[model samples]
Target: MPMPRRRLILWLATAVISTAALPPLYAQTPPPTVAAAADLKFALEEVAARFERDTGQKLRLVFGSSGNFYSQILQDAPFHLYMSADEGFVFKLADAGKTVDRGRLYAVGRIGVIVPHGSALKADGELKDLAAALKDGRLQKFAIANPEHAPYGARAKEALQHAGLWDAIQPKLVLGENISQTAQFATSGSTQGGVIALSLAKAPSVAKLGEFALIPESWHQPLKQRMVLIKGAPPAARAFYEYIATPAAQEIMVRYGFAMPNEK
Candidate 1:
């Protein structure tokens, strides 16, 4: 026997009412991810902490060579913001439509040479000591970030080449994947000395282990560091991006030995 039309309509209405009573699904927002340069390891951590305290927003930092991060971002990595050691990388991303726009210059980096305590390279005579130690065969190895991909490494190479020391130092060089690792190689006593970002040398971990001398900015091109917000960045990322330019964040970078872009 066929069911009556009124009974069928009543059953359909009950099903619709039960479904409507259920809660609607809401999309959850993911935490912000930042691709940061290795030189920022300490400085960014300090700034991020202050940012969190002020804004109640937490951010995850992934540190590596800026050039490596550039290649990763090109591959569609899920970073919400990028803090590059080289401004060129940020500009390249903007040109590729990967970033929101040409980002702001956040800091200027400087390079320096660090010699660990108890090493043959003493701080009193500085570079002169390095020369003497090398001539006496007391200094056998030196570490530096790989110039092929790390901005600081490139600067370090430039400084050596400018001083007519590259040809001699090249053979004894121990390359690190990045500046932080280079500092480690020097401070850990794995190498006699290293040329690294001044910002890293100012970090307490490295400062206590070694003494560093400024490499004079004239030896190489300027390290104009910049940062950008990735396209479709979350609210937290955007907020943090703006916060980086604030006085508090800039002060942290200054404390870490970074020169403000406009401070001259």
Candidate 2:
């Protein structure tokens, strides 16, 4: 039987968590929902899977831009925890009384250039190749997450600006909704290449599609990834939040190319 529109709205608003929803990620569950930045897609999934396997506690993880997740939390989206790619979001939520307290830094993120195999562009960390390609007309569309709301995108913009290519590259930009999609566009052969979270580029699936190199960290603001628990977080949510700081979780993050907070 076809469900009524009212019931569907209620179910979707309260239960389902998907990136395609009008306004995405959400509330309650057999286990509480966790809103995480898209940059953490690969690393966090592995950490959460380990948590579930070892502790027998399940969690519903939803990934998207950190800024969007912050807005959702402000609207009382019911996510039991939030892992933001930028620590500022967590601090802002803490000030707003949305989170229990300011979150702990879980990982330090890095952005890099990914050029799909056979592109004219080279995976140059210093962006010298990018500037050369832009000047020589070898570059057309270049993918990046939307800088307005995605932390990794913001860093990518800063790096380009530092390289003095922001204005020149502006004509050839393809903006993705988040880091994962940015990496996808970079490797899909749609665009020549792009700047995306290092963690995403490190994924075996993504790595096979391209060559990647870390953009110099000095080019932009730091990506201090942090995680926090909601005021009324469930036991599983609290436990997972704690577990993310453990050695096991940090190792998973390192595997995905993130630097630990404790590192210099």
Q: In order, what is each prediction's RMSD in angstroms? A: 4.5, 10.6
* Pairs that clash in candidate 1: none
For each candidate, the alpha-carbon lDDT, in order, equals 0.88, 0.91
Instruction: Tell me the number of clashing residue pairs for each predicted model.
Output: 0, 0
lDDT score, candidate 1, position 222: 95
lDDT of candidate 2 over 1-264, digit per residue (tens):
989999999888776555455552565358889999999888888999999998989989999999999999999998999999999999999999998888788889999999999998999999999999988999999999999999999999999999999999998999999999999999999999999998998889899999999998999999998889989999999999889878898789999989888732
**What's the TM-score of each model vs. the native?**
0.87, 0.88
The C-alpha stretches of model 2 lying farther than 4 A from their native spots are 1-29
- Model 1, range 36-142, lDDT digits (tens) per residue? 99999999999999998998888999999999999999999999999999999999999999999999898999998888988888652225666676678987999
User: What's the CA error at residue 145 for candidate 1, in Å?
Assistant: 0.6
